[model samples]
Target chain A: METVDLKSAGFGSNKVIEWGIRTFGKIVTRLLLQADVVALTIPKYVELLRREYGAQNVLLAPHGSFEDNAVMPSFEQGAGPIKIMTFGKFGTYKRVETLIEAFAQLQAPEHKRPALELVIAGTDSPNAAGYLAQMAQRYAHVPNVRYTGYVSESDVPVIFGESSVVVFPYTSTTGSSGVLHQAGDYGKAAVLPNIGDFAEVIREEGYTGEFFQPNDVDSMAQAIARVIDNPANRKAIGMQNYRAARGLPMEEVVDWYMLHFETLLDEYANRKGKIGLAKA
Target chain B: MQIIEEITPEKLTLRLSGRFDAHETPQVRQKFTEHAPKNALIDLSGVTFLDSAALSTLVQAMKNCRERGGELTLANMPQPVRIIFELTRLDKAFNIVNAPDAP
Candidate 1:
C-alpha cells in the first residue's frame, strides 16, 4: 500500500504531454490499485478510482499542511502601510503576473487609499528570470512591492504570521491546495478566485475570506481593496477564520483517517470470509 | 472606466461605466474622496457586475457621505447590480431608484 500526492489537473493543457501522462498514470494507477490500500488527497479522484476500477482499496485522506496552529502573531501595519503577501512557487498557473497587475492598479495616494505593502516571496520556476524581470519592470516604479527570492520550509510559518492577507490567484486546478490550509491554519484572511475547493473552504469550512470572479484581475483587486479599506471587517474575518481553524484541529482529522482505515480493513476481511465460505 | 462627473458644491454625480470592480474601483474611490458632496449620486446604468469588495467600498463611501451631511444614492441601476444589493439587504441602506417614476 502506498500514498501518492496526485495534484494534477486532469490531462492538462498540452495534448501530447497530457496524452502521455494520462496513459502512463492510468496504467500505473491500475497496477497500484492491485495493492491492498491506496490513499488519495482529492475526494473526486478517490470516487473515480473506486467506481472506475471497482477498487475498494482506494480511500481518502484529508489534506494536511503539518503546521503548529498556535496563536498566530498579528502582522504589523506600522503607521504607513499594510503588508499583503502571496506565498508558494512562482509559476504561470499561479498567476503571479495577474496579481501584480491587480496590485498595480490599487496604487493611490496614502490618504485617499490604504497604504499596502505587497511581498512576492517564493522560489521562481519555469522561466523564473523572465517572469521576475517582467514583474520588476512593471512594478519598479511602485515603491511598495518587494520580491523575496526563495522562502524555506521553516520560514513558511513566520511568513504566514506576518502578512495581513494571503492571495491565491491560481487560474485552474484539479486538486485542493495546501496554501488554503496553510493560510487557514494561521487564521489569515485570503482573497482568492471563486472556484474549486476554495469556494468550499470559504462557504463550507466557514473560513473568513472573499471570492473574486475567476481570472479577472480587477475582481481580484477589488477583493483586496475591500480588505484594506475596511480594517474592522478584515479583522473580524481573520478572527472568524482563526476560530474555524481551531475547530478542525489537524490531530482530530488524522484520528478520523485512522478509524476509517480500521473500518475498511474489517470490511475487506469480511468480504474475503464470505468468498471462502462459498468456495468451501 | 469612463467617469462622467458633474460636480457642484451641493452635489456630485458620477456616471460609472464598464465593470465597477477591483481594478477600476480605485478611480471611483479617489473621486469620491476628492469630491464626495453632500448629495452623491452613482449612476450605474452601464455596470454589468459587482463583487463583495466593491460592495464594501460603496458602503464606506456612503458612510463617508453621510458623515459629511450628504447622502449617497444609486440611480439607473441594472437588474444584475440591483440583485446584489437585495441579496445583501443593502437595498434598505441605500436609495435605489430604477426609474424616475418607476413604482
Candidate 2:
C-alpha cells in the first residue's frame, strides 16, 4: 500500500485529518449503506467511522507504522548513533531556533558529541524564509546540522529510524503534534517544549522523553543533554512507548472499521429485503 | 460597534465594545483617522472577541500615532481580549491596562 505523509500539522495533523475524515465519512457511509453501498479506509480512522457514520457500512484495513517494514529486521537494542530529527515550516512557533541552539550547546569538545546529527527537514513558512535563512547562516559553521528542504513520506521511516530522539519546540497555544506520535510509534524518544497538547500526549503515554520550558534555551539544552547522555534510559523509555503504541496499529484499527461497515451494510440489505418481501 | 470617546490632556480614550473582528476593524481604523488625535487611549473592556485582523488594525493605529509624535495606549481590556493579545505576543507591542488606575 502507498502512504502519503502530508506532514501538515507536525504531530497532530494526521489525527485531526483522521478525525475530520471519519466524521465526514460516517455521514457519507450511512447514506451509502442505506442505498446498499460499501466504503473503506484504514483503521486509525475507525473512531470517525463509529462516531459519525453508523457502525454498519464501513470496511477497515489496517497498516503498520509509517516506518514499519515486514521484510526488514527491527532493532533490539535502541542505543545507536543518536539521530535528532525535527520537521516543520520554519517559524517562531516551531521554535527550530531553540532546538538548534540546544543542540549546539550539547556538543562538547571531548565526548564525541554523542554522534549528534540534527536534521531540520521541511520548507519555510509564509514570510519565514528570511528567518530560516538567517538560522541557516547562524548554524552553518556548526558541524552535523543538516537542513533538508522537504522530505516525502517514503523517506520518513528511513529518517525516523535513524533518529534516537525527535524534538518539537512549539510556541503556539493551540495545536497538535503529529511528529510526536509518529516518533512514539517508531520507538524513538521525543523532546517537546511544554505547550498546547504536547504535555498531555507525553504524560499520558509515559514515553521516554522530556518537556522543557518553551522559548528557554537553557532548559531546552538540558533536555537534549538528558537524552544524549543516557542511552539506556532512552531505550527503556522508547521500548515502553512501543508497547503503549501497539494498540494504535493499522490492523486493529481496520477491523474496528470493518465491523462498523458490515453493520451499516446489513441494515441496508435488510431494508431492501423488506421492501421486496412486501411487494410479493 | 460601540465607541466611547474620552478626551484628556495626555491621551484620547476610545472605549470599544462588542465584536472586534474583520468587519469592525475597518470602522475602527476609519474612526481613528477621522478623530486623528495626538494621543489616544483605547479601552477594550466590553469587547467580547478580537480576531487577528482587529489586532492588526490596533497595531496600525499605534504606528500612526507614533508617527504623529503621539502614543496609542490600551486600557481596561477584558480577560479574553487580553488573552488574544498575549497569544499573538502583541502584549509587548501594546501597553495593556487591566484596570483604569493601572497602565
Colliding pairs, model 1: A218-B23, A222-B22, B38-B70
All candidates' lDDT scores? Answer: 0.68, 0.63
**Deviation (Å) of B75 in candidate 2:** 59
For each candidate, what's the DockQ?
0.01, 0.01
TM-score of chain B of each: 0.90, 0.87
Error in Å for residue A262 of model 2: 4.6
Tens digits of per-residue lDDT, candidate 2, A1-280, equal: 0122223223335678766665665566566667432433223234344455455333332222443332332434346656678877776466577788877777767656646778888877773556667788977877788887778978877787777777877775332355665776777767778763555444433344777898788898888777767877677656655644442445434433443454456667899999999999
Docking model 2 quality class: incorrect
DockQ of 1: 0.01
Top model by lDDT, which number? Answer: 1
